[model samples]
Structures are given as C-alpha cells and as structure tokens.
Target: MAWNEPGGNNNDPWKNRGGRDQGPPDLDEVFKNILNKFGKFGGGKGGSSDGKGFGLGISLVVGLLVIVWFISGFYTIREAERGVVLRFGEFSHFVEPGLRWKPTFIDSVLPVDVQTVRSLPSSGSMLTEDENVVRVEMEVQYRILEPYKYSFSVTSPETSLSQAFDSAIRYVVGHSKMDDVLTSGREVARQNVREELQAILEPYDMGISIVDMNFKDARPPEEVKAAFDDAIAAQEDEQRFINEAEAYSREIEPRARGQVNRMAEEAQAYKEQSILKAQGEIARFEELLPQYQAAPKVTRSRIYLETLESVYANTSKILVDTKGSGNMLYLPLDKILERQNTSNAPSTNRRTLEGLRNQDPAAENGPQDTGIRSDRLRSGRN
Candidate 1:
C-alpha cells in the first residue's frame, strides 16, 4: 500500500504522529527554496567577502595569461627578415625589422628572409635542338619581395618555384643546340630560364624575385663523351693550323713582295745600263766616222792597225826581217820563250815591245817582218 493508505499502517507511529505534508516538493517551491538559500549565502557580508576574493583571483589569473600571451606574440625580426601579419586568415600588413607584435590567436605572423639570397640547384638530362641529350646543371638565386604573396599566394612557394625552374630549364634546353649548350650557349640558356621562371611565377602570384641563374656545368652524356672530346680536340687542332697558316702568310708575304720589288729594280737598272752602253757605242761610232771621211786611207789603216794591235795585245810573237839580209834568221823563239816563261810573261813582253816600238823609227815594219819570218820558219829556210 501507498504510504498514505491507512488500512495497514493505521497503527504505524511514524505515519500517525505528523499530518502528511505532500507527495513531492513542487518545482516552483523547490526553485524558490534554492533561490532563497543562494540569496542568503550570496547577499550577506561573509558571502560578499568570499565573492570578492574569488573575483580577484580570477582577474589575477586572466591578467597573468594576457601578459604571457602578449610576451609570446612580441617577436623581434632581424635585419635580414621581414614579418608578414595575417589576421583571421587574411593578409594584414608587413612589418619591418626589429620588435613587432600581433594579437594572440586572433592574428598570425610569419617571418621571411627577404634580404637573404637563396640558392637552388637544378639538373636534368634534356634534349637539345639538335636532338642530342645533355646534362645541364644550374643554380638559381632568388629573394622574397612581397611577404604577403610569399606567405599566402602559394601553398609552398619554394616547391612551386623549383618546379617552375625545372620547366624553364627544360624549355630553354629544348630550344638550344647541343653544341651551344655545351659551349657558349650557357649564358643564353640561363637568361631564357630566368625569364621563363619569372613568367610562370607572375601568373601564380609568387613573390620570388630571380636574382640570377648560372649554368654550372653542361655536357653530353657519357656515351658520347669520347666523341665530343675528340671533336673538341680536332677543332683545337684546326684552329691551331689556321693560326699557323696565317702566321706563315704574315711572315712570308712581305718578304716575297720585297724580293719582287728588288728583282724589278734590278731589271730596270739592267735596262738603263744597256741603253747607256748602246748610246755610248753609237756616239763613239759617229765621232770616228767624220775623221774616217776626212782621210779615208789613213783612217782606215789606223783603224786596221788599232784593231790588229788590240787583237795581238794578249798574244806572244816573234819577228824577223828576211827582205833586208836575204836570209832567214833562225831565232829559236820557242826555246827563248820557254826560258823567259814566268807568271808575268805577258806583262813583261808588253813592256819590252812598247820600249822597242818607241825607239824604232820604222816600227810598222816589225809586224810585217814577223809574218814573213814565221812563213820562212814554217818552211825551215835560213
């Protein structure tokens, strides 16, 4: 039975002693009771004292937390770095070097090394314009210009930049010749790669500024390395040969021209000498012709005698006069000549004959007697 039922518990002392208050407390009454206790404990002097102490403790904790948070947000940037501030996941502004701060949890900051030159190396085997494969190694230097773009515009700026660099290198390599890639074309390749990378980054809004691109090494593959080396050697040899030829030409050309000039001068001198000699001979003949016409017989005889004298000037002779004694005088001239023979026989004989001719009044008869004596001597007559 229920507790209020009286049939079984009429004699129960607990039930009969007090009149029944209620089955359960009403919601309003319970609420009012709690409110009254709360008001009584909260409104009194003791209660007010406890409430103020608790509020003070809470404020102290909150202040400490705020100080700690502020200290955490107060970061200093170095001279080489730039700070990027993001509020509520949006770019706010860039902070310069030195002390900087942002609200905790409400704003975020990223420090980028803007002034630092970053280097990235890229390498790959690429096909050139000549359809030859070559390995190209290069280095790219860059720096951040816009901190906001660097932090938010791309998910990973370095990775994206590297990808763009690879694409640019490939594009440039594809358009270049293998010989150029291995030789003087490296500078061109670097410029083209830098330009292409800049173009790609511009569209992606990347904040990277390309400082320069340098080609470290570029060469043909190992399979063709020997052939390329041989080709280079051959080219060097060819250049050496060309230089040698040029030098030879440079040294010999002037000498040849000088020789030609000397020969021409000699020929000209010969022509002048021949003309002067011919004119002298003609003048001499013209001068002699007038004398010859004035005294023909005497001039002719003189000319004949001069001609004979000139002809016999270098010869040895023996003379005898058979008409005066009517006897041939055997002079034994060959024996006398043998006895007088010396290194200066011709000069001695010329002097002796000249002295005799100067002393004799009929010197012209000497040669006539010489011829007759020679004829008698040949006939062995005395």
Candidate 2:
C-alpha cells in the first residue's frame, strides 16, 4: 500500500526500516541501494525493483545517443558549390547543393566552388627570337570544371598552371622578335602562348578550363626606355599618316569619279548630237541631189542664197555697199534701233509742224504727200 493509503505505511520510500517516522532516507543507504541494483545486473542478489528501474534508464540513454549521432551527420552546401563525397578516404560519388547527410566518420564531403572565376598572373623579362629581352605580363582566367578531377588529378593545379604559363610564354617569346612583342606582334604572341599552354596542360587533366588568356603588357627593357618610347612614337606617327592618307583617298576618290562620269556623259551627248546632225545633213543632200540634177544653175543659186540667209540671220551688224564706192559703210543695227526709238516722237512732231506751215501761206509751196515721199526715200536707203 502507498504511504497516503488508508492502511499501508511500508510504501513510503523516505520511511526508515526502524519503523520511525524519519524525515528522509539516509544518503549512505540510498547510495548502497543503487550500487546493489547495478551489481545485480551482473548477477548480484539485489532487489528486483531496483534492477528493473536501472535497466529502463540504460535503454533510454542508449536510444537518445543513437538519435544524436544520426542527426550530426547532416550538412548543407551552398548554391554555387559542388560537393565531392569520399568514402573511407577514397573517391565516392558527388552530391548536390542543399542539406545532405553522410555517415559520420565514414563518408566525407568536400565542397568546391565551381562557379567562381580565378585569375593567375605571370610576368617576367623573357628572351625573344632575336636574342632581345622583353618584359611580358599575362593573366589567365579559369574556373573549376570537375571537382573530383581538380582535387585528385594533380598535386597542385594552380602551381602547375603557373609553371605552364611561364613555359608557354617563354617559348612564344623566344620565337618572336622584339618589335613584335612590343607592337603588332602582341596579339600573335598571346594566341601562341594560349595554344602552347593548352597543349601542355591537356595531358594532365587538371580539370581547369581556361576561359581567357590575355597579354596585359608587352614592352621593351627599362634600360632602353627612351629609345623604345621614340620607336613607339614613330610607329604611331606612321599609322596616323597611313590613316590620314586613307581618309583623303576616300574623300577625294568619289569626286574624281563623279568628274570622270560627268565628262563621259558630256562626251556622249556631244557624240549623239554630231551623229544626228550628220544624219539630217545626209537627208538634206539626198533630197537636193534630184533638185540639182533637174536644174543645175538654179539649184546652185538657191543654195548660195540659203547659205547667206543662214549667215546673216546671226549677224547684228549691217554692212552697206554703196553704189560705185570703194569704202563699205558699217552700222551697228542694235545702236541704230536704240537711236530710232529715242528720236521717233520728236521727229513726228517736227514733221507735223512743217506740214502746218506748208498749209499756211507763210511756207513756200512744197510737194503734196511729203510724208509719203520721205517714207519712200527711207525705204530706198535701207
């Protein structure tokens, strides 16, 4: 019965065996009892109740330990990272990003960031094909491609890459002249070096892909800095002169072509005009051939008169051959036209006044129709 039960006092754990109402069990007695129960688990003669409670405690502790060990194996990988799993210090499979689990102390995960681009620079004074020294600086940009290969292919991939760059650059520079290294040959040298580097690295399978390789600097030695500067300036000046010549050629060539085309067009028009004029003349001659055969002298005279008319139609000067006079009279018809126009009004008024006077008895008798007579004289003179 329990201690609070109506008739059972032996169920009280704090009650003394002396049947006294003790405050609590003695410390020595509690310790002894626990030791006796643990001893009974190995076949000691302890109380059955003590052994059962101790057995349940051991089972609960072991279960809690198992749960802790399983949860401890979980790990997380980031978005850009690639994880390589190793089982017992040997290569296993790969794992992706996010929370993952591996057996503790058995499988290990190595996370390598494959997305980040890394750069390595190699620069030094190297000998050229011409036995000239030139300083060159270059950078290689790369990223990890295969995590397992990168981890296990070579002892140290970055160091190997640096050595490879040095070797390739030296090889290319050795085959190139100093001027090329410093100027137009820089691009060729860069290409050659990259090609050579790739060739050297392919057998090793370093698992690094070279994104780009750049020749950052290619220059002469500092000892000859002034000379190199002058050389570079002259090269620039030569390029500038060539560019200017090209620009001038581009600007002036079209104008010359246009002028040539214009001259050709004008010549073509002149040629067509001459051909048409010749055709018309041929037609005219063919028609006039029959006329000449019908009346020789009359056709000849008619042709002469037609020629005179064509010539005189274009002339503004009038030449008058006076009768029996050795000297010919010359008059500018344009000037005569202007003078006649100016004096016409005054001449008409004078003529009218003269007629009035003649009608009156004060003027001497004159021929009738004097205006008509004057007009006839003017026409005869013309």
Put down candidate 2 lDDT per residue, 206-285, tens digits, no spaces. 88898998889988877998899899899999999999999999999999999999999999999999999999999999
Please, what are the lDDT tens digits per residue for candidate 1 over residues 290-356?
A: 9988987667656655655555555555655445666665544445656775665666555655654
Residue ranges of candidate 1 with Cα displaced over 4 Å: 1-49, 237-382
Candidate 2 lDDT: 0.79
Candidate 2's TM-score: 0.65
Name the lDDT value of residue 319 in candidate 1.
58
lDDT of 1 at 135: 93
- Model 2 regions more than 4 Å off: 1-55, 288-313, 317-382
Cα RMSDs of all predictions? 14.2, 15.0
Score residue 279 of candidate 2 by CA lDDT: 100
TM-score of 1: 0.51
Q: Model-by-model lDDT, in order?
A: 0.77, 0.79
